[model samples]
Target: MEIILVVSFSYLSGSIPFGLILTKFFGGQDIRKIGSGNIGATNVLRTGNKFLAALTLVLDILKGYIPVIISLQYFPELIQLSCLLAFLGHVFPVW
Candidate 1:
């Protein structure tokens, strides 16, 4: 049960569409409609907003890192799985 919680949290955290949200909020543009149609920082960069791209990059990295660190305290055995699932979640987000 604890493992499940950790994994779910990790995945959900990583799945946040930071790039998309920031792009739309600040630039009023759909991130997916520009560049390579990706929701990652690189695509966000194409919106001509360096700050948004940098912020998205940092937030995205933090989402993955924070979950793993939190899991380490209570679910040490799940650290590796949490990291991998977090990445997969970013690639194929539930959102």
Candidate 2:
């Protein structure tokens, strides 16, 4: 149960589309329609808002990093699963 909870948390955290949210909130444009049409920081940069892009990058990194750190501290045996789920969540987010 704890493993499931941790993995779910990790995936959900990674699935947050920070670039899309930040760009839309700050730039008033859908990031998906921007340059590369990607939801990552690289595409956020295309919006010409360096601060938003950097912030998105940091948030994205933190989403992944925080989960791994939690797994390391609370469930070291789940580190690999946590990392994989986080990546998958980012690549295939529910949102």
Candidate 3:
């Protein structure tokens, strides 16, 4: 039960499309329509806003890291699974 919650939380957190949201909000561009069509920092760079891309990179990393950190601190047994799910969510997001 606890494992399910931890993995789900980690995946959901990592699945957030930070690059897409930031670019659309600040540059009014759909990130998916530009460059690599990816929702990562590299794709965000296509918007010509280094600051937004950098922010997206940082947030993306934190999304993956924070969940692992939380799982380690509160559910050490789930650290590996949580991290794996987070990566998968980022690469193949549900959203």
Candidate 4:
């Protein structure tokens, strides 16, 4: 289904652990073991790169918002239902 594909793509995008990668590739620390130990925005700040963490937060919000906007533009009302599920998928990835 087109809707399924759209949500799947959005979740995939959101689930990308940018903070984790930044820590590993650049700082050689697994961010998950640091301060708050979350892969999300707040924990990233503990890495001492406030700018990068802020950027990641903005980008993460956009990662959810953009796909929802696109789905709305094309499919309208259905995006409301789908976007939340997609966002949840990102927050708690099973894949």
Candidate 5:
């Protein structure tokens, strides 16, 4: 049950779509409608907002990193599953 909860949290966190949220919050054009139509930092960079791009990159990294770190500290046996789920969540986000 604990592992289930942790993995679920990791997946949800990774699926946040930071690039899309940042672009929209900063009053920029929809990131998905521009360059490559990806909701990643590279696409965010195409929006001509370096700061937002960098921020998106950092946030995206954190989303993945934090989950693994949590698993490491509290659920070491789940580290691998946590990492995979995080990546999958980012690639196939719920949102």
Candidate 6:
């Protein structure tokens, strides 16, 4: 039950598409159709905002890292699964 909740939350959080939204909001560009066609930070960089790109990268990584870390703190055995779930969220995001 807890594992399901944790993975679901991680997926939802990671699928935020921050890089794409921020780039469009600030630079008025669709980051997804540019560069690697990815909604990640590197694609955000193509939008011409170095600061925003860096921030997005850090935030994205944190999105994955934080969940694993939190899960580890509570249930050490779940650390690996948590990290994998986070990665999946970023790869196949809902948003």
Best by lDDT: 2
State each model's CA lDDT, in order. Answer: 0.90, 0.92, 0.91, 0.76, 0.91, 0.81
Question: Could you tell me the lDDT of residue 2 within candidate 4?
Answer: 77
lDDT of 6 by residue, 1-95 (tens): 87887788777776778887778888788887788988778777776779999989888888887788788888777777788778888888876
Local accuracy of candidate 2 as per-residue lDDT tens digits, 1-95:
98898889999998999999998888789999989899999998877889998999999999999999999999999899999999999999999
Q: Give the local distance difference test score of model 3.
A: 0.91
All candidates: CA RMSD in angstroms?
1.0, 0.8, 0.9, 1.8, 0.9, 1.6
Ranking by TM-score: 2, 5, 3, 1, 6, 4
Residues 1-95 of candidate 4: C-alpha lDDT, one tens digit per residue: 87777777767766777677766777788888989788877888887888868877887787778778888888776787558766786788753
Per-residue alpha-carbon lDDT of model 1 for 1-95, expressed as tens digits?
98789878988998999998898888889889898999999988888889999999999999899999988888899899899889988988998
Over the stretch 1-95, how does candidate 5's per-residue lDDT look in tens digits? 97888879889988999998998889657889999999899998887889999999999999999998988999998899999999999989999
TM-score of each: 0.93, 0.95, 0.94, 0.82, 0.95, 0.85
At residue 33, give the lDDT of candidate 3: 90
Q: What is candidate 3's lDDT per residue for 1-95, written digit by digit as tens?
A: 99889979999988999998899898888999999898889888777889999999999999999999999999999888998999999988888
Compared with the true structure, the alpha-carbon lDDT of candidate 2 equals 0.92
lDDT of 4: 0.76
Worst 10 residues of 2 by lDDT: 20-29
Estimate the lDDT of model 6. Answer: 0.81
Whose TM-score is higher: candidate 2's or candidate 4's?
Answer: 2
Preferred candidate (lDDT higher): 3 or 4: 3
